[model samples]
Target: MQLPESQVAVLEAANADEATPVDALAAATDLPPETVTGAAFELEEQELVAVTERVDETISLTNEGRTYVEDGLPEVRLYEAALEASADADPAQMGQVIGTSGLEGDEVDIALSNYARKGYGSIDSGELTADPDADPAADPEATALESLVDEGTLEGSEDVLEQLERRGLAEVTESTVREVELTEQGVTELMAGVETAETVGQVTPELLTSGEWDEVEFAEYNVEADAETVEGGRVHVLREMSERVKDVLVGMGFEEMDGPHVDADFWINDCLFMPQDHPARTHWDRFALEQPTHIDDLPEDLVDAVERAHREGVGEDGEGYHSPWDEEFARALALRGHTTSLSTRYLSGEEIGEIEPPARFFSVEKAYRNDTLDATHLLEFYQIEGWVMAEDLSVRDLMGTFEEFYAQFGIEDIRFKPHYNPYTEPSFELFGTHPTTGELIEIGNSGIFREEMLEPLGVDCDVMAWGLALERLAMLTTGAEDIRDLHGTLADLEFLRNAEVTY
Candidate 1:
């Protein structure tokens, strides 16, 4: 019987008496494990070999876990220190115990959190007490870590291993281990004798030069064979979504706008008609720059115009906040809470000169806010900002624009509720039903720019604008329940890798 070189090599290495793993076969046959695996599957299909597959989990200690094995686990060390300080009978100051434990920075917190959970001790207020009966030496997680160090793997310690993994002290990976053994047919074939066939796996330069390619037999590929999955570099889901948004907005006849991430409150809020004393302008909601506290290059005329609008009002009938408006406060720099600063800059001819009437502009940019992190909120996020400077713009135009924009992403059921924004009159929040949860999520805010905002920017025409959450738009499209899952320290890599940006 004649077989491809790889198949013949695999057959010669595989044993009838014992199953040999693909790695062992690869070593014996001098072929890649994947090649051996593919050959084994082909032999199995031909009834020449039996291939058995099982998932094998590999356990290994991380750098931190190794350190714990050498210096003792943080919690264990803390307990020992507490006991030495007579904490078993009475509470000891946490700082003193931690200092004695030699734990610093994040390790101190790690020790404290796990100490209570593992029955090592109780941490009350600012004190720590060691449990006299607690045995740090017999700690399952510590024992598991030691076992991994000694034996290079673990068994019957799933719970402990999981705990260690959660603590970022250990790593566990699963791989499909395939073992091949000769079947009755394979044994018979070996007895009958098999020969290696000269089959070309790929076209070579020598073969082409010699004009022997036509005469050579090509090896048939096993397309069904399990191959290694390679997770090559890919554009992040958020970045991809941002680019897609740019494309959509560009298609909708809007030119992209660019500006500073850190800008003067003058353009960010003052130009938007937000009073200096507005709650949203406070340090609690906005990130203020410390070193270069104030912006030096604010346009003078625009600053005066905005200040007048803030203090005295925009038109004859327009009413100001009557609040104390200070140029010094307006010049204070902060990480932009929104990308409306770009709109203000552009409208006032401070950015790319004055954008004339009937012009459309948009920006997909980062905005920093000291927001309470939650399922729907993040500290910093991409805001899809846009504005239309045209004649007689209205709420209908803003609503229709949002409807068209979201519809492109397959979200047709957009609902709007009247909301308030200091910059825009008749402001409303945009909501879209989450595909997975079916709950209406606040996706964006939109309204026509109020006279107080526009007149200062030297814009005589009507303007409708919005600052949409790019992450929320992604959630609506990708069905991610938590905004953190999109991007952050707790980002779900598995979800991001598989998430498809619909539309």
Candidate 2:
């Protein structure tokens, strides 16, 4: 019997008495593992060899995991600290115990989350208690990490490994391992004497010139063989969504706006009629700057106009906040919490030198805020700010515009609820039904710009504007349950690679 060189080599290397891994066969035949695997598959097709596949997983500790193995698990350290404070007898202050534990920032949260889950103790009302019976030294996860460090791998403890991976303390990789062994036909053929035959793997110019292409035996290809996955560079879902949003707005007759991310409070909140004492303007909510605290270049005339509007009023019937308004406070610089600052700059004719009626402007920009992180909220996010200046506008116009815009992305079930904003009168919040959860989520805020907000900006016509959450829009479009899955440190790479942004 005759066979291709690669196939004969693989078949001779494979043992009939025992199954050999593809790596071992490659070593014996002095061939590449991929080539040996392909040859094995081809021989299996001819019923001369049997090929079996199994998934092999490798586990390793991440840098964080290694640190824990050396120093100690965060939860274990917290437990030891609590015990030292006599927390096992009575609940001790969480702050004191945590301070003694030497855990800071994200490590504190990690310790708290795992401490209660491992039958360690209970945390209640700013207090922590340790379970005297619990043994921190015997924690399965810590044990697994130590074993991996010493032995380079683990035999069992799948559940513990999974928890470690979830906590970002470990990594697991899986690969398909193929094993080959000779069948009855292969052994019989080997005993009958097998010979190597000339086989062509590809069509060559010489073969064609010699007129031997028709008579040459071509090697069969195994289409079902396992191959390596190669990930190529592609546009991120957030960037793709941003471009699509710009295109949609431009198509709707809106010109893009641009401005500074860190600006004076004069344009960010003062021009919007927000009170200086408003809670949202406090350091707890806004990101205040340290160096170069105040802006050096605010238009003098515009500053006077805005200050008067804040203290006195906009018109005969307009009334002010009846509070102190200071130029020094307005000059303080900070990161803009929303993109409305751009609208103020454009409306005051300071950006492009004056404006006409019936003009449309929009901006898709980043905004910073000191917010508690959650599934829907992040520290910084993209805000889609827009405004329309015309003779007359109403709530009906704003709702219709939203309906038209959302329809482009296949979202039609939009709900509106009355809300409050300092700059817009008759303000309302926009809500959309979540595609996956079947629950309503707040998507944006919109209303007609009030007289107090517009008169100071030197705009005589009515303007309707809105600040929409770009991440919420993406959630409704992509059916993502968490905003972190789209972009963040904990973002899901597999989900991003496969997530499709329709429309």
Candidate 3:
């Protein structure tokens, strides 16, 4: 092959310096190392240079790489070995490396392998590892602790702790008993409110077309008339849903249940009858929090029943979950993606345990996912969750409550199709007709809690659970085509402000 100008330059440079490493070549040439390495590689491939070797058949060439010698066109050397050794490098790095390794011929490739191993780390299929021969390190528990501290989720740092002791949000921590507090700045931030004002003089007509106002601070320059702007003055839509869901429960004479969103994997998954080895427990499926609260006090009776269920399917010990359900794995912490968090929440209330005939509870909050953001998917979105606990609660009871509930929204023709949710037996995936679109939309899922799920919550009765995407509901009601259209707007917020909040 006829050598290109860049190629000839690299071949000449290679002969000038014989033993220098690729890294040094990158600097010496004043070029990105990848460029030099690249051209040099081309020269070697054409029988110009020779290469040498390492542990595996990794080697360099033997002759002057792409030799431009005594004759006009020169005796070109195509050193296959040298080119092969540096094959993984970017074109620029290859050119520089070949130039620096001043080997007279193709032997430069041997030097390139040495270049990568030392400066670039271990080469695996041409990729670099920080420390190749060693196993990658898993995150240390302390790293998670540090993250929680950074996020202001955890308390303790002796100096900070001591200062917090005396002050509240700004408390001076002198003792171990630091009050959990938020600063006035933090309070304003957490309560979600902010105010700003701006007034800017219009630029002269000449300035307008020239972008003269680009860097202007309109807020600081306002004249006589005062104007103000305020934002974040409301609870999140998800939070609003939670309140509405709670109202639905309270109106039915049910009290709220409280549980931390930071509970361990055991309560979130295992206690709820999820198998430890199930795919949902994997990192891809759920958002595992750095510092999670572990539910240590598993009600013994429920624990035994679940253990039996797992050891044997629904009934017999035969064909049941075989492996030992790991207790440690169960205690892992993660964000509560489902309002089923309400399950443990209700269990914590004595009234739930003492309730006579009928009891209902609900929760609404954001569920997370790894889905890509699009018209129909989001990493986070709102879920409206509700459930009722009672004896012999027929599927009819379940349909009746839904009747009253969906009626409030003016939606009709509610129907359920058989579905399987891991925690619910006789489950349902709800479908509703889009009032305007006339298209059938599957909105949510519901089912009476399976024996496996209820056993963990200490509930012996049939507990029915149902959930739907609040965002989807909003999208339908607001005539939105995209999922993102649902919120963070003045109109949407105003709608919530004015919407009927029926009990």
Candidate 4:
């Protein structure tokens, strides 16, 4: 049968009586390893040869290991220095001799321990004395390291390799090596003589026009062969979902709002009725800025109102926390923990001119938190914050808005648990049933702005607002179990390439 030149060469080079490693065959045939591997796979498919793969663990020296070899092992240097010292030499500290031998810090301890362990010397009465007959050639570790540097690889006792590994002198890695053998059919075929003519895998226009295709052999095409996957450039899954969220909010008659990621604590906490002594305001939860300690140009009247609300409370039946409110603390700058700061800015008329009742505003922007990185929590993430300032909005309005908002992303089963927030009265924790796991996952925290929270911002109307986690929303729609896979450094590229865009 006609075969490609590469395949024919591989088959002829294989020994009929025994298997040959792909590397050995490549060397003997003077062909590239990649070419030999590809031909071996093709020949195996035709039942002319067999391919076997074995994983090999190899030990090699690291840069530090090579340096130790060049400078002589720490123990060896210590031994030689102890041997060369005068018999009347002052009693020497083992550490000092190690130091004199060019060993420093941990190296000194390492050399002393190894020197004693090898029975090459004794450090008795703070005096170091080397064994006169302790031959350097008796050191196996030193010999092993030098051999590894020269040979580039070594196969030996795993215990020896592990000991070297623990010292940070070498590392062990696994590699798969392919071995090929001529099968009975391959031997029979080779004995019958296989053709080495070039086989065209693809028909060319020139060949078709010249009619040379009829005179040449064509390679057999295997329809079942796997091909490389092609991934075209596409929008990041998170960006696509963010745009979709904006589109849905806009469709619901909500105008988009914008705010600074770095802003004064007055707007982030004070305007939201969160006291300066609150735990969430602590250094553990919030990222305080070093520069620009205080925000400038804040409205004096609004600042005083917020301060009074915190110190003395406002309106009848409004008993404040009675905590002394420091305006300086309120003016201290920090990274905003939530986009609700944006809603606070807009509702207080500090951002836009005036906020009339029955107006809707939303912001999908990043917020920072001093949080530990995990599968679900990120140090920084996007928040979907929205607020409706109406004269008589109720809890039902908040629930209905969440239902409609989640429905836009194909989520229908949303349950709310009554929870408490410093700024929201009768607050709720939003939960959605995970599409893949089927377990309910808390996705957001929200509630109607309490009278205390709203009054400090000069808003008399009831404000129904919610701050939802955009990453959690994307996870449910995209079926990603780890929120990190949506946008974090650990994001899966394959998931992004195949993520469904419908939701």
Candidate 5:
């Protein structure tokens, strides 16, 4: 390939100093580092002083190549047989979208029909094909990725994940999710920008005429089409629902409490009256962090209270689980599976001391469990945990709040099943009717705080804590069999951004 002016400059610079840095070469040449590097590479190929990052390919060509015979070669890469009677075409039918436009349409339909056999991102298309020559030593993407990395252009392990994400090619935990519910104001703006995706930026001559067309990616032009009027973007349905729940708590004059996705067993299990021996504590039932270490700074009283409850019930009966509480075990840190721990702190702390007679708190944080992943379960997920405490909170109040919160999510048919919990006196499990499945899907569990849990916190009144699975609600509302349907879609977001999902 003919070397560009930039490459010629890189050649001259490399010959001048075998000691200069890659950055210095770019800076001295007033060229971007990548361009400078590529130029330097071409110079080496043309027989200048040889240098390269690859160990096996150290130097460029030598002067001897200048005299090498130019072999006679065919100009064309390939040509079809003259008048070849149609490449896999019917003998007579030539008009109606046959071959790619027709055949591919059928293939695409089949791929979509059995989605269980494939993924939304996976399709029977040329773009989805694996690189024919993906070398262990030379993944082109990796080479670019590595070069960028070596240049300090890429930062974290997730940096590539982020880059791919920014261009709508990557997904991360913090990525903006278009929700299925939107405010009236959001819908107004969305309707305004509906055709925004269709309009492309004017292609500058510098780009189309740069002779760097080989380097330009075709995928960028393959932007998602907006010709067919469809949904736009917004937050995720789960997030939208979670926000509604948050709003409800705030409107109820309840303090919105927050906590870590990771928590201590003392807070997650013991403080909330979860028995260590309970099946939920087993690795099979819940995700236990690889290392069992406590957070650096934990409230001493919370630790002590949780410990006391574990050793002996923190109740009027003054009896614990009738077993010795393991302090070391309690101190072991864990991924927070529910938001109840947030309430544990609010109910029994000196910070709340004498500040109020009645209080309420809630959380909508991601939780982790160890169930096999399925439409019904995920190893890591989110939960809406909450609690209410007062001079006289009763079962009636519990049922009232349950009905109200579910109703907020457009769920009305709910059944309460008698249940048991280490931390509460009268425990219950809440099951909501699945909209599409018509199955009684358990959404959450709740109960009044048991003495072992509250007595240690020094709380004088009974408290109840409950949590709902946000994904379950999403599945019910969207009629999606897979939890992933709630994610990775502009439609999902548009639906949420325009959805009116509240009382």
Candidate 6:
């Protein structure tokens, strides 16, 4: 029975013999376009008026198109030039004709090619000639262009529109326009007249202070209407996964190891028995630092031992690599390629207290590699590294550890294949079948630390170590098909918001 002033005004203007566009209605009512739009929508919702929308495609000239209209289309110019020439004029090369037409680059080829296709001209051996009946003044395209310039739109076949679009002569765009008209019910309601009341959407301080709030009626709200989303605070999913991994490792009696992301290659590679000339130690695989190019804190004694291991084999019956060893390369600063570097640091006893026999150490930390990004691999990612130091560890112990480790995450089907690593002997690569792809994806690398690798670190016991992918684990556990979907810019916000963290 009661309507706002804006709604009543819009309804009155729309009560016409024919539907009127929103803009026209606004003009007739002397109301702002935006105000008229809102009022029209409200009236429609009340079934007092009907609103219909139409989508129109309009063509307009771009900067280059305007220039063509001022001069002439490339094909048209070429055709005119050919027509003005002598009937028996020397056959003009397509290029020369286009050049005479003032068209160059892609426009030259476009003009010559389309001239023949449009039946306006013919091209012979590198020559161009106009059709005897060709006339630029009567060209349909020229007429279409003139019409577009005057009316700002073209009513033509799809082929005509596509031709102009392909030649970069015009741009086509779509616009949606709405029209409003009163319904039969609206006419009846208007005849009875509309009455408005002082209704409050919110109680203002002035109204409360003046004690006038109780005298006015408040508009009823549609509680079921959609509201803005409010996201509550929670730890990031990656951080939560990190915490869960830490809990699993700790539960398995593994003491967590922590170290710097940037470190000397001495501990990361040299102490791990990696040859100085190894490809992975090169710039392509390692991120070498510019500032502070070399770390000076490496222990002198440890450096000497690692240097000897590279120059000379570890134990009896060994032939070390004959390649030259450079101490500077060993001391070069770089981002750690794997958290196994931390394992090397801890086993060396420089940090995380002294490494004793029967030691179980693991590091769930970030590592940087000079890697190309893809659906699965990231340049920087979390690596799950763990090492167990015992009197005499075997490959069986390594397999068992992985079994129990993945078991915590409900991954039971794990298989290992013999593989090779620079630091670990009897090496094996861990694999798990992808749930979606059904392909066996490599999870990580593991093997027993060779004497050459352990001796330099001052660890006399047999050490079994493994480096696994944390992202792959997250993907498997959380049903993420793409590893990138778990983190980084490409991650889906909707998926992150609704993704339930698996225990």
TM per candidate comes to 0.72, 0.80, 0.48, 0.63, 0.51, 0.65
Top model by TM-score, which number?
2
lDDT of 1 by residue, 1-503 (tens): 99998999999899999999999999998999889888988888899999998998888888888999999988899999999999999999988998888888657756765788799989777788889999887888888888888889774466777567656678878888889999999999999999989888899999999999989999888997877798877789999999999999999999999999989988888898988999898988899999899988877888888888888897789889999999999999999999999998899998888677889999999999886455787879999999998898878888888888887888899999999888888989989999888999999998988898888888999999999999999998998877877887656676778998766
Q: Score each candidate by Cα lDDT.
A: 0.87, 0.90, 0.51, 0.83, 0.55, 0.80
Which tens-of-lDDT digit does each residue in 61-143 have in candidate 4?
A: 87878888888888888887776663124446665666568777555656766777788877775578777778887677887
Best prediction by lDDT: 2
Error of 3 at 233 (Å): 6.1
lDDT at residue 260 of model 6 (Cα atoms)? 90
Task: Write the residue-wise lDDT of candidate 5 on 1-503 in tens digits.
Answer: 22345644554455332345556777677877655555444444444434444222111111221111121000000001101223222221212212222223223332233222222122232122212222323322233334342463333355444323322222233211111122343234334542212222345677678865555433122122112335556566677777877887788777777666677777777777676777777766666677646556667867777767666654466666666667667767777766676677667663355425567777778877765444466666778778887777777789889888777667788899999776776889988777655778877888888766777777777676787788777666666555544553212343346544444
Worst 10 residues of 3 by lDDT: 69-78
Q: Tell me model 5's lDDT, rounded to 2 decimals.
A: 0.55
What TM value does model 6 have?
0.65
Misplaced by over 4 Å in model 6 are 4-187, 226-237, 478-500
Order by lDDT, highest first: 2, 1, 4, 6, 5, 3
Better of 2 and 3 by lDDT: 2
- Poorly placed runs, candidate 2 (over 4 Å): 54-102, 108-174, 198-221, 289-292
Per-residue C-alpha lDDT of model 2 across residues 104-138, encoded as one tens digit per residue: 88677668867887988998877999999999878
Model 2 lDDT vs. the true structure? 0.90
lDDT of 6 by residue, 1-503 (tens): 78877778888888557888988988988988767777787777888998888998778987777877787777887787776563225566665565567777656655655687678767776676677776678766776777788887675677787656655567787866889889988888989988765567788999899999989887545443223458877666677788888899999999988899999898788888888888888888889999999988778888888888888888897678878898888889999998887988899888866767888989899999976455577889999999999987899999999999999888999998999788889999989988766878888999999999888888898999999998888777777666767777556555577765567
